[model samples]
Target: MDAAVAEAHVAALQGEDAHAAEPFRMSAVKFAMWLFLASEVMFFAGLLGSYLVLRFSHANQFSEEALALNWPLATLNTVVLIGSSLTMALAVSAAQAGQAPRTARFLGFTFVLGVVFLVVKAIEYSTKIHHGIVPSMSLFYASYFTMTGCHALHLIGGLVPVTVVGLRALRGRVDGGKVELVGLYWHFVDLVWIFLFPLLYLI
Candidate 1:
């Protein structure tokens, strides 16, 4: 009888263990992307903080350098980036809806807009360089180039994934989650530009 009671208790414990709930889990890709973006946010925050400090220390120089920037052209680029964000959102929507062709079309639009932004930015840089307004010219110019250059690099990095996913979408081999992940990254890039344009150009 004692042996049988011990065996029954062991069986009950085993059953409880077998029925236990599993630990929570998140998608590895999503978790990684969010972590990456968080680190990027801190990095950009540091850059913007340093820029503000420099701007305050050399107010007059900043104002003088601001004159060299073409706000009108930057405004146009702002519009272009904003348009790209719209297209990216549409691509995500279409992808979620399982509309492969529509997703591809929107993604193509987004890629073109991104290229236009880079081209316009290159033109701006060329104009500045033509006037001998290099980064070594002033603290303001250094800050301007550093911030905008970092931003451009991020945008360029985002474009690669956008191209890959867009091509896959065209082939009907893309998933909504993949497009959504790219959209999150692309939106972050666009948002960084939105902050940068007003700070480095208008203000």
Candidate 2:
């Protein structure tokens, strides 16, 4: 019944039902999500292109002076993120199996992992600020901070929805696909960091 209601709600919003009160579909909500993610991919592509141009332009100047970010800590955070993705997957599986308690358990764990990720990021950003490498300082750090800071802000945005979904799950009110939908976005953010980590810190 919820699926039917979800479909009806989406079709009404998209005016699809007016054309044809037809069979069920992925719904407008899911379609909009795909559109949003596609736009995000393009956005990141532009930022990456800018970063690469700056990197080559400054190779001979400050190449050796990289803040030498805490590689081990970043690597650990990567593991944590990947683990959260797996836990999110498990939440979906438990929901499919009709196990609300287990689903909530996994979802709650993933949310806590997100919080841990933010805390680690705070430490990382604090270190960068401590060394006086503001974005206006140099061309290299300028682009680095701008690109990475934008990514961080998106990550925070992703966390907000995930936190809300987690709270709903705790009360057994959240749908499985809601968890899956938010998880999809959360995982994409993690995947972006997988690329940005090496580009900004290691390379």
Candidate 3:
């Protein structure tokens, strides 16, 4: 064959193979995740907005009700959550590097930290309830519980996928893209808590 025809043939074969690749590629998955996160952003935005409106509307009562929260426990949970985010990032890095064992270990650590955060939050909730600071007691209490409760639910939901990913990593079945998607979600959860911690506990 002539040199020009030979080059064209090779290029055509490469194009065909590329076109025949998997339909559900990593880019598709990442795009879907971005869309999902966008919706979650709006949902959380509404919740935070409601909480802020309530807080500012009843500033005096809100301050008094905020005094009922266990700042020490909340602060501790914040630290645990931030630590978990770090571990989650490391897990993604390991997955990308194709180190399945390391990925699994980091993911397991992240899961444990998530559990610790929930435990501390549960303790704080019980303490507040014991002090008669239930949601119905005041607007601040209501906003606080609703915001944190939704967050806790998200954390619980996130744990399931994290556990599954970690198990898959142990079996050397997880791909880097899946790990990246999960990491995005985990980071979002941690970021929400970062905002909530100071908003509810400190400020």
Question: Which residue pairs in model 2 clash with each other?
Answer: none
Tens-digit lDDT track for model 2 on 1-203? 99999998787868956545554466677667878889989999898888788778888654565555577878777888778788878887776676777877887888788778778878887897899867787777787777777777877787787677767767777576677778778777887888888787777
Q: Give the total clashing residue pairs for model 2.
A: 0
lDDT of 1 at 29: 94
Q: What do the candidate models score in CA lDDT, each in turn? A: 0.91, 0.77, 0.88
lDDT of 3: 0.88
Query: Candidate 3: misplaced stretches above 4 Å?
Result: 1-26
Among all candidates shown, the one with the greatest TM-score: 1
Using TM-score as the yardstick, the better of models 1 and 3 is 1
Query: Which structure among the candidates has the greatest lDDT?
Result: 1
How far is 47's C-alpha from truth in model 1 (Å)?
0.8
Model 1 clash pairs?
none
What TM-score would every model get versus the actual structure? 0.86, 0.80, 0.85
lDDT of 3 by residue, 138-192 (tens): 7777888899999999999999989999999999886888889999999999989
In Å, residue 123's CA in model 1 sits off its true spot by 0.5
RMSD of each: 6.4, 7.8, 6.6
